[model samples]
Target chain A: MIAPLLHVTGLSKRFGGFVALNDVSLQVAPGERLGLIGPNGSGKSTLVNCMSGTLVNDRGRVQFDGRVLDGLPPHRRAYLGLARSFQLPRPFSSLSVRDNMRIPLLYTAAVRAGRQRAENEIRERTEELLRVVGLIDKADARPIDLTQVDMRKLELARAMAADPKLLIADEAMAGLSNAEVDDILGLLMRLNAQGISIILIEHIMKAVMAFSQRLVVLVSGNKIADGAPSEVIRNDHVVRAYLGQ
Target chain B: MTSATAVENPGRKVQAQIGTPMFAALATGVAVLFYVALALIGNEYLYFSGYVVLQFVVMATAWNILGGYCGYVNFGSAAFFAMGAYSTVCIYSIGTEYARSGVGKILGAIPPPVLVPLLIAFAGIIAGLVGLGMGYLTLRLRGVFFSIATLALSVVLQTLVVNWDFVGGSRGAYVIRPNEFPLLPGGFIAYLFVLMLLLVVVALTLARGIERSRLGFGFTAIRDDELAAEAAGVPTLRLKLIATTVSGALMGMAGASFPYYIGYLQPNSAFGLEYAVNAIAMPMVGGTQSWVGPLVGALLLGSFQQWATVTISSVLNLLIVGLVLIFFVIVAPNGIVGLVREWRRKRVLRKAVRP
Candidate 1:
């Protein structure tokens, strides 16, 4: 098998006495699509937070693209081609949507290119990303003016601006119509097709089943199952703990 | 894809871009015009009051670099200002001591024209280092916590200044003002006014330049949501530290001429609460979002305070600020700049719909 793009080992996080994630280890191969799902009060977000450097893990290590991401800040991780969208859309409200896209491009993509990107190049790239997310018309609009789904789209597009090798979308579709979920799923599929690995964390089963090649289940700070999507769903432990068989 | 073709560079069409150098030239032209007007008026009282107003322009602009751009409210304006004032005092005291000594007469002979600019630069460097140090210590605390720490910092610095005796301490220090300036017609007060006018030009140009650059975008991102900014690859801490240092340096430069202007430098006067309040209020009252806001706010409010001090009572200045601030908070929550933006946006919408 090819080497994994992301590897988390024995990751543990605690808030006071309560363990948020404990001994959680996982791997995603290059160009793989992995689904991370868990019940309420489970460690899914805690794990993402640790991996993204929003919150430090009490113990264990996170490796991404052949580099150890132990104490690196989130911006440093983005420099290394790891990017995540917040569970809630947190666009720079004061900025227009296109300007929002410019943040990651200016900071991460430009730095990665190792040369200054011309203003026209940055503007064109921004427009292209906004178009991909179907937000081209709303480029001049403020984030506050966008609909819920469009806000999510803007969030994803902003993350995509970094040209990340690995994208961890934390619940990119939470409260969406069936149509909106499919729209996001299609966007994610398009991004994945461009040689970008994706770890999709979602509660929506239909989208997850349709999107993830592999599935990982978390329950009460522990990974209960990790395997092919179909087999993982059929696992007795996952069914009992999460699928509610 | 068809819609992409339809849009056809919508962002470019909307943006009326001005290069930084062009903007700076225009701003300097406007400032030079104002300086000429003031010099032609040739009133020393006008220069004195104008110097106070222009000084606020620098302080308010400085405060906005961190407070308005990055959403970090620094309540230690007076502390930084006093740091600059005391730095000037230190230099002045040293010069006086050297003049009194037989062997060191040559060192004391350094002329005011050369000496004043050096003192301003020195004060800026000293205050900038202090700002960097303070930001490193306190930037981790967000929102109100950061503000509280800044307030505490001012108090601590004030106590330190009151106790330290070398630069006159609680007893205060005197800086003998030169009666004449060689180059200009209106003497030393006019020289101070001209220096402050140039400083305003520098501060405004710097503020406007930052507002349009990548650094400005990072600052706006931090102001909007710091967590998202960091995740988006913007270095929030470094950007914030830069803001603090720049902000502190400008405030220090504003104060560098204070001892010379006032002829007396007391800890209480230099570390006046008025400096801190006016610095914050000017930005908030004018609008914190753009470079234009602080300048507008400082000029309007600073001029009014000066007028009130002359026509009514000096004691009423703070009371007027409080009243005006409350009125603006209720009536124009986004400040004057925001109000203008909202109006302009509506007008555009109206025009678009008319066709």
Candidate 2:
């Protein structure tokens, strides 16, 4: 197979004596949809944080798009086209919806493109992203005005504004309705079709099974299974560790 | 795609909101008009009072850039202000020694008006460098810890000044202003007022520039949620450094002129708690959110303080600030600008419902 877009090898994280992520390794190919699922406290979020450079692993290496991200901070990682959305929508409350997108677009995408985008070009891109997420009419509104599902969509759009090579979406549809989950799933599929690799970390099994081409299961900071969604879900170990409930 | 085309260029529109050239012209005109009115009135008290208020305008504007925009509360503003005030002391001693040794021809030859701007710029640079150092050292602490470090910094600076005898130790040093007048007929105080008016214009321009620029966007992101801002690709540390340096520099510029205005400088008055408290309170009262907030807060609260100093006791000046600060914090957490925005928002909502 071709070189993976993201490669986390022998990653381990410790919170005092408790191992949050222990020797966990995973990979995602270009244009691939990978689902990362685990029980609560199973280190799914910890793994995402390590890969996104929010939390540095105690011992391991995160290689994204050919660069070792050991010493790189989150913004530097983002500049290299690694984008993430928080489990909670963390929009700049002082800024309008459009400026929220502009921060990532201006800093990450423009820096990666190595050119100064025209003022109009940024506006067009921001509006287009808003339109895609069904937030075009609320472009001028603040994040405080957004509904829960809209805030999640804004989070995704903000990440998409980075025009990343790989997107690590941490629980993008955690509390959404089934219809809203479908909305985000369709959006993620469209993003994948446009050639961006994505790691969807979700608790909802149906959404996970519907979207992931490959599924990786973690049990207590360790990867229990990694393969095709159907095969991984049916695995005896994954069933015992996670799916038995 | 068609909807995207229909949307106006938001970036260009936001830039247009600031009206850069128009703002410059209007601000310049207003400053000139203000000084002209003071000159025509020919009242020394008016100029003196106006100078103090204008100084607060600069201080408040500077403080808000870091405290309001970047969400870094600096409780050591007096340290930077004192640094600027002490810069003049340093220059004075150097010039004095040169003249005493009969080798100060170059220093004495430059007119005081020309020298004042040079001194202000030098003071600003010194304060800015200190700000950069303090930010590098303490900004990593986060929230109240950072503020505590700043307060400790003030005490450290004050102790150093108290011990240093060159600037008169704890006794205070006298700054002798030249009797000659070059730019204005009203001599030293009037000249200082004009210099301060210029500083006000500089401070306003800078604060507004940051408010509308990409830097402001990064600052707000840091303020909102620093972790998310980092993930959003904002270099938070670098932007915070810029804000602190600029804020400290302007406060220092105001302080550099303090000795000439007061004719005497001491550690207590220069590094007093009043400067720090007033600088912060003005922005909090007017609104910490934008450039206009600090201006309004300074003019209103500063003039009120000046009036109280003349009418009531000097001790009551801080009392007024404490009351106003408490009122704003409890009633309108967003300050005066917030109140105005809330009022406007309600009016719009009411109108929409009526239709």
Candidate 3:
């Protein structure tokens, strides 16, 4: 009965001659864990970019929280409660991990709160977020000092600092050990439990299967399947294109 | 997110250490230093040379705001500086003509205190707008392309100034120094030196304020990774424009007093290569990140250049600057401030290990 929190209709993107996303339509209800999986160059990140306003779609529209997001910048989208983590963990190298968390909190969440939050409150929130992500010990350390998994956690924490209604985490668990993957999966699940809707684009099938309640499959810029995770995984085309018979 | 106790943290400690009181104390200390220097220096030549060195401090500090903090390199420092210098010429001509008209004789009597600052403010605004225009045109071009555009902008501005007969053609224009100050103790040169000293303080304070503010955080975010900053809700284009305008305006403010100092300003002298190179090199040699780096760098390099000009040939001043800059870039790319921080960090590590 409720309208979808995020609704994408006929979304298409092109990079000159190559079509990256073609008429990809999808929807996510509030607080839903949506999995988006595609093989390399299958427009998984492209769709995330379009929805996040990093890249503008040539066709179709993205509707978030009942507003049509036609031509907004990434920061504007962030202000409207949309957030994303980069594939390569682009932490502010010069800043401490604490500062990294505080910046996004200040610019997005605090600005969205209309600067009503006190400095103490912001600092407390920053620390709380850091602690939740297990980066409390390394709060004063720079991004360069962080390990691969910590960098990923920091990236996710920075996204969390935005206090987004919808978070599209692009490949957050890539290149991590199985245990590290579980660590991130737990973090994402905790965030989801706190009522933040998430669209996770991941190559790690274990994480995708463990985290995604609803699954969507893309292949060469086309949406192949959209249904329950078990049903989508069992679909003939999805297995042929992605899961490999 | 889980509830956490309000514990003593390094982030809070660092923030507390550098709040309003610290900056206020720094300002007072600098003011006292200048006061003592003013009373001690009786030589006219020392005051004259001191003015130029302080001017560089202002320029370097301003340049670093955009170049160092925001990672936007500007090769058109001369253009902004010249805009200020030329603004002064235009204002001087207009004010002098107005004074000669008998009704404005009263206005001419109040020249030094009233007119100079007004003209300087006007110069700053004009240069700021120009900087905004330049940013609009070229800021979309990343790194080397943006720098090249600024280089081209300097040449274009120089050509326009050379042909503009109103202010001064290629020949030159003379700015007559005012005879006296009503409220101030310093005569003309002394007053100019004092004005420049005040300008240095203002520029440093402004730079420091920006370095500490939300805007400063936004700037570094853009500097580090623009896409990431944008996704984090920093408006990159707007921040870049602000940085460019503020940086350009302060450099223009420093240049506004140039005509009076030089007395005779030609196109080559006003839009010289030295202005562009020194503006960049000082900040680079000092460390681009913080306001202190540029201040320390400008003072060291500026005084050294002054000393070099006096001892060696004037031509060798630039050569020495070139050598120092090249050496610093290769050996200490982060500058003197970075070097000091590294040294201090090593000392702390050694102490920690032993203790």
Q: Which candidate comes out best when scored by TM-score? A: 1
User: What are the per-residue Cα lDDT tens digits for candidate 2 across B29-113?
Assistant: 8999999998998988887899999999999999999999999898888898999999988787667757745535565566778
Superposed by TM-score, candidate 2 places the C-alpha of residue B56 at a distance from the truth, in angstroms, of 0.5
Q: Candidates sorted by lDDT, descending order?
A: 1, 2, 3
Error of 2 at B72 (Å): 1.2
DockQ of 1: 0.61
True contacts kept of 2: 0.82
Q: How close is candidate 3 to the true structure, as a TM-score?
A: 0.94
TM-score of each: 0.96, 0.95, 0.94
Question: What TM-score would chain A of each candidate receive against the reference chain A?
Answer: 0.98, 0.98, 0.97
DockQ for every prediction shown: 0.61, 0.60, 0.51
What is candidate 1's lDDT per residue for A1-245, written digit by digit as tens?
A: 88899999999999999999999999999899999998988989999999999999999999998999998999999998988999999989988897888888879887877765666788889888988999999998989999999999999998999989999999999999999999999999999999999999999999999999999999999999998999998888988996466
Give the 10-residue window scoring lowest on summed lDDT in candidate 1 chain B.
B2-11
| Residue range B1-355, candidate 3, lDDT tens digits | 1112112112233544454345656786886688567757666787778889998998999899999999999999989999999999877766566777764475466656677887788889999999899989999998999999999999999899889887888988888887675554456777778878888878887787777767888898999999999999998999999999999999898899999888989989889888898999999999998888999999999999898888888888877888999999999999999999889989999999999
